[model samples]
Target: MMEMFDFRTNNSNGSVKRRLLWVEMESVFGDLPPSGISGSSHNSFTVEKSAITPQECENAVSLTHVGRAGEAQMVDVSPKESTKRIAIASCNVILGKKVFDLVLANQMAKGDVLSVAKIAGISGAKHTSTLIPLCHNITLSHVRVDLHLNPKNYSVDIEGEAASTGKTGVEMEAMTAVTIAGLTVYDMCKAASKDIQITNVRLESKTGGKSGQWSREE
Candidate 1:
C-alpha cells in the first residue's frame, strides 16, 4: 500500500507524455457534513438549503441506500493512486468570565479540564472511523491538539491536527477530534458556566495526495 509510482507514456508521434497519478479511496458518506441547517430568524428558510438539495450532498447520503437486502454499490476509486495525506481542523468555544476564571485557576470541579480534553482530542483523532460511520480506518502518524484562551471574551480556541500516509486525508478525523474535545471541555466546565458557545469548526490545512495542498485563507 505504501508503494509510490512514476510513469511516462509514449505517443504515436514519438513524443512522451508525462503525468502523475495518485490513488485515493474515500467514502462519500465520510465526506458529508454531519450537521444540518436549521432556519433562523435572521436567515430565510429555503428548500434549496436542505442537505438533499445539492446533487453532491444527495449523492453522498443516498448513494449507499440500495433497495435490495445485502445489496452493494461501491464507489469507483479505480482511477485513484496512493499518496501521503494530512489534515488539520479547528474550532472555538466562547466561555463566560466566571467559568474562564475557574478554568484558568484549575478550580473547576471536574479537575484538569484542559489536559483531559487534550488527551481526548488526540484519542478522538485515532478513533475517527468509529465515531464517524463510513470512514475508513487508517493508521495515523500524528495527532496534536492546542488550546488557547482569548482574554477579552474568555473564549478558547481548539485546534486539532491529524496526519497519515494513506489513500485519503484525515480532515474528518481532525474535525471530529476538535468537536469532541470542545464538547468534553464544556462538559467538564459546565458547572462553572453553562453559556459556552462552540463556534467555527473548520479544516485549516491539508497536504499530499492528488489534490495537492490547501490552507485556510487568512
Candidate 2:
C-alpha cells in the first residue's frame, strides 16, 4: 500500500519547498521513482512513512549482522543518524519472607545490599558492550538502578534505566544492569535463603532512533 509522507530534497543549489508525497517502500530500492527525483540538484530525499509492519521490516534486514560467507559480524551504524536513546528494564528477585525482611531492614552481611547492587548495576551498564559481543560501546549520559521491596509478593523489584546520545539504543545496557543487580542480590543474601529466584528480566520501554518509542503495557 502507498502511504503519504513528508519529503524534501536538500542540495547545494538550495532547499526545495517541503511537501507531502505518496511513496512506497519499493521506491527505496529504485523500483519506481516518484516525481521530482531526476534533476542534478536532487541530492537526497527523506521519506518519513512506510507501508510495512515493524516485524516485516526487521525480518527483511535480518541478515545485516551476517556476512555473505555466514560468519558473525557487527552491524555498521556509521551511516545512521545519532539521536538521544533511552531504555528501561526490570527484574524481580523473589527472596521469600525471611530474606525480604532482612533486606528491608538492611541487615545483609555484605554491607548495604541495595546500595551495592545499584553500583554493580551501573557498572554493568557501562560494560554492557563487553558482556555482549554484538553490542556497541556507546557513551552513556546517565544510568540509574532502583530497587523496591514489594511486600505483597515478598520480592525485590529492581529496575534499571539507561540513556545515551548515539547511533544505537541502550536496551541491552538496561537489561544487563538489572540482571547483574539481581545476581548480586542473590550473592549477598544466599546464606540467608537458598531458593532465591530472579524472574522477568526484560526491557520495559525504549525511545529514540528511527523506530521511535516503544513501551510494554502493564
Candidate 3:
C-alpha cells in the first residue's frame, strides 16, 4: 500500500493546517509498505492501488508453447503414455461449376483429380513433421483420405483421418493431410478455373490422448 504524508503549513490566523498527500511508500519511508494501519483518511483522499499479491502472481498461467524466458519451444511429450490416437480433419476445394464437372468426370488434364488428391493427402500426413517445424514426428499406423463431390456447392470435400500410437496427438497430421489434399484438387482444376479456393480447413474429431474424445459438435 502507498504511504499517506501530512505536510504542515501556517494559516493567515497563525493556525496550523495539514494536508494529506498520497505517495509511494519507498519515496517517503525508503522501505516496503508496513503491514499495519498507517493513518486515517483526510477530507480529500488520493487513493493509491496496491500491487498484486503473491498468491495472485503465483496463480497466473502462460502459454504451453512458450518457455520460461518467453521464447517459443516445442512441447515435451516424453513422459506421456503411448495410446491409440486418431484425428480427423476436413476441407473443401471450391471449384467453379465448369471445373467441377470436369473433375466429376475424371477428365482433368492432371489425371483423375480425386485419386491424385487422396494419394497426396496420405503422403502429406506422413511428412507432417517436416512441413510443421513444431509438430512431432509420429509413426502413423493408418491414414485414410476420402473425397466427395458436392453438387450443390460445386466443391470437392476432402477428409483425412490419421491414427497412431504415440505420445503426441495426430491432429496436426490430419490437418496437414486435408490441407495438402485440398491444394492438390485446386492445382488439378486451376487450368479450368483460376478462382478455385481451398476453404474451411479444420479438425473434425479426435480420440485418445489424456483428454479422451472430442468432436466439432462439442
Candidate 4:
C-alpha cells in the first residue's frame, strides 16, 4: 500500500512549512497496485534547494580529485600557480637497551646508523612518486633528515624536511622520507636487538598550498 506522510518545520520567520512525501509498502506475494502518479511523471519526486552559502558552494566545487560519481582520480594542478613548497615529517624508532647503548657509542656492527638513515631518507624523498601511486613526481630543491637520540626512552627521533617549487605540495615526499628513515634505522639495529620498533610516522607541518600552512598542535 502507498502512504503519504507530512513533514512540517518552521521557516525563518516562524511560519510552518509542510512537505508531503510518498512511501510504498509491500505485502506477501500480491499483485502490485499502480501509483496514481503517471509512469513518466516528472513531479513524482521533489528535490529541495540546497541551503549552502555561496562560499561553501565554491569550496565544494573546488574539490577536483573526484568526479560527481565519487570515483578516485588524480587532481589536475596544471592551472595552479607554481610556488615554493616545504613540508616536514617526523617519526620515532624505539630500540632495546643494548641497541640504544651501541647506537650512542657508535659501535653498531652495521656502521653509523644515523648517517645511513639520513642518506636513505633523502633518497626516499627524491623517489616519492615511484613509491606512492598517486603522488606527483616533484623535483625537490632541498631535502634534510635529522636523527636525535633520547636516552631515557631508548628511542631515536627522526625528522625529514622537503622543499620544492612546483604546482603540488611536498608533504608526501616529507612523509615518505621519514618512513624510509625509520625503516633504515630498524635494519641497522636489528642485529643488535630484534625488538626494535618504528612508530608515529606523520607530517608535522606543511607550507605553500591552496589551503596555506598547517602544523600539528602539541
User: What TM-score, computed on C-alpha atoms, does each candidate reach?
Assistant: 0.65, 0.71, 0.73, 0.70
Candidates in order have lDDT scores of 0.74, 0.85, 0.83, 0.82
**On a 0 to 100 scale, what is the lDDT of residue 155 in model 4?**
95
Model 3: number of clashes?
0
Which stretches in model 1 have alpha-carbon errors above 4 Å?
A: 1-79
Off by over 4 Å in 2: 1-63
- Which is the leading candidate under TM-score? 3
Task: Give the clash total for candidate 2.
Answer: 0
Query: All candidates: CA RMSD in angstroms?
Result: 17.0, 13.6, 11.2, 8.8
- Model 3 lDDT per residue over 1-218, tens place: 65332333335432221221223334455454333436734333345544766588679774778766456799999999999999999999889789989988888988999999999999999999999988888799999999999999999999999999988899999999999999888888888889998999999999998989999998
By lDDT, the candidates rank as 2, 3, 4, 1
Give me the runs in candidate 4 sitting further than 4 Å from their true place: 1-65
Clashing pairs in 2: none
Strongest candidate by lDDT: 2
Put down candidate 1 lDDT per residue, 1-218, tens digits, no spaces.
13222222244332321121111111322232222335432321112212333467546635442433334643344466767888889999888888888889989888998899899899888888898666778789889998887788888889998888877768988998999899889999888767889999999998887778999974
Q: Write one digit per residue (lDDT tens) for candidate 4, span 166-218.
A: 89999999999999999999999998788999999999999897878999964
Candidate 3 TM-score versus the reference: 0.73
